[model samples]
Target: MIKFFKKRPPANLPDFWKTYENCFLEKQPEEVNSVRFVVLDTETTGFDYIHDRILSIGALNLINKHIAINQSLELYLIQDHYNAETAKIHGILKNGRGTECITEIEALKQFLAFVGNAVIIAHHTIFDINMINQALERHQLPKLLNKTLDTSTLYKKTLLTSNVFKKKDHYSLDDLAEKFDISMKDRHTAIGDAYITAIAFLKIWTRLKSKGPLKLKDLLKLGS
Candidate 1:
């Protein structure tokens, strides 16, 4: 009789990953006000996810239209890849005194721990989500599993869709900020942008709710 080698079981995910993943095990709240919303933004070296590096990630939780500024996440990541051309855009120099920068792994760890299973809201949801997913992939981790909301799309839903006013395919954060009268005080910075997004989202939520009863499911369904 030939003896066959026993197949080994795949290793379990690390404790941090497990902790992040476990947040989803509990059912999400059904009501909009009861649900937690995490508005997030990332500042990168460039557009190409494969080549670019995330210089910073800023995020804060919004609940019942209130954001506790003291509890926000404003993480700057140390860089190995630098782009001089884009420095002016994000204002995060390679080794400048912006904030205490951490390693990529540490940043990812902190970001994951902070985000948990809250609904993620961003301006252009796909771009930021893809950028983060790419970073996670490079670190040999699973992609983000949280539901995402795009203020761009949600903002469109609040608009009047008539032949008189055709909706543009895309809307910039600045456009929404201008339309909603949200100040551009912290336009490019990660945490600043996240705060702007949070305010814009609350305004849009009011518009959406004005039409009818808007549940958490309604907003989740509208977002991509």
Candidate 2:
């Protein structure tokens, strides 16, 4: 049944995407400060484009520099395809740990409900976002409409582009986590990692803002 839907396109795409996209069409505040941002991640079976499947999704919402524990998206999916090779990095064993699994469609529905109208923030935004989009496509749903901000890009903004050191061409979750002293307690879990990313982003924003006024558009800066 799942295979029939894979990569084809989503059916009965929830109305949420339309509404979320509409938020963008409206006039955005000139000050880039008052926006809601969602940071998220996907645990996949493997790195293979064709073989890998999303095993889980973890995310947290950031509004006005606050992160509330009750408001997070942690979804475990039922995936027959599990990769032992990536287990060490993400730690989701086949039928071993983590919460009970939900179907891919169920997870997407819940994810949409949680993420509605908020700008998405993620580390390596494309992969995670695309993973979700592929799932949506399979369900016949359209792509996500929310604006996206990548922390890797935001982290780069903290660096000085003095034409020396090249300002670290790339930034990884591990790098930002270490720099900010954030514990990897919920390391392999989606929500735990999302929390880590959220905190790291805050620290980066603080440092950048100290230099001058900050705005939502400014934080959306993926590059220097």
Candidate 3:
């Protein structure tokens, strides 16, 4: 006789989380131009995912090649862990930055609502996505279900094979800014960097489309 282990029941999630999850029930758009994309950046205390915490999150909505300035989101979290060294980099003080800081849970709620089921875009997406997921885990919440695109990865595909030797293994946001001629005015700030990444993504997307037709699946494949 074989004995099987019982599956664990789903954890009771809050209404906001439930609402966020519900958005995924609708089918995702197949056309690249039709899909809503959320370009985001997160400033953290340090590199250690488990040990460090997110100091702030900045994101904006992009659809049909247009950046929705009014839909942009910027949230600062009240941190229990702060690194002075990193603070010098991001400039988010423990006390506050004249802007009101919300609790991590509150930030998560707002972030989820703002994000919905939109595809996430970031410079180095894994780090930012992991940071957000870790925060969600800490609150007994599940990780984000949205698809993601990394500008660094997507930008790499825009390069020509003739100049293969000139390609670097990794491309930094600063490199994209200089190559695309975007301003570096908000270099270290989360929202500023996100805006820069959004611009870089648009430029990269346009270049990719110049070669051939680019559907959402095709772009996601290239990004992956």
Highest lDDT: which candidate?
A: 3
Poorest lDDT segment (10 consecutive residues) of candidate 3:
159-168
- lDDT (Cα, tens digit) per residue for candidate 1, span 1-224: 99999754236767898899999998788898889889999999989978898888999989888897888999899889899999999888878865788998899899999999999999998888988989888877888989999999999988888989999999999999999899998889999999989998999999988988878888889876
Q: Summing lDDT over every window of 10 consecutive residues in candidate 2, give the lowest-scoring window.
A: 1-10
Error of 1 at 155 (Å): 0.5
Candidate 3 lDDT tens digits, 1-224? 99999754348989999999999999778899999999999999998889999999999999999999898999999989989999998989889688999999999999999999999999989999999999998998888999999999999998876654677889999999999999999888999999999999999999999998789998988895
Model 3 off-target regions past 4 Å?
1-10, 162-164
Deviation from native of the Cα of residue 137 in model 3, angstroms:
0.4
- At residue 184, give the lDDT of candidate 1: 93
Between candidates 1 and 3, the TM-score winner: 3
Model 1 stretches with alpha carbons more than 4 Å out: 1-10
The RMSD (Cα, Å) of candidate 1 is 4.4
Displacement of the residue 3 alpha carbon in candidate 2, Å: 34
lDDT of each: 0.89, 0.78, 0.93
By TM-score, the best candidate is 3
Better of 1 and 2 by TM-score: 1
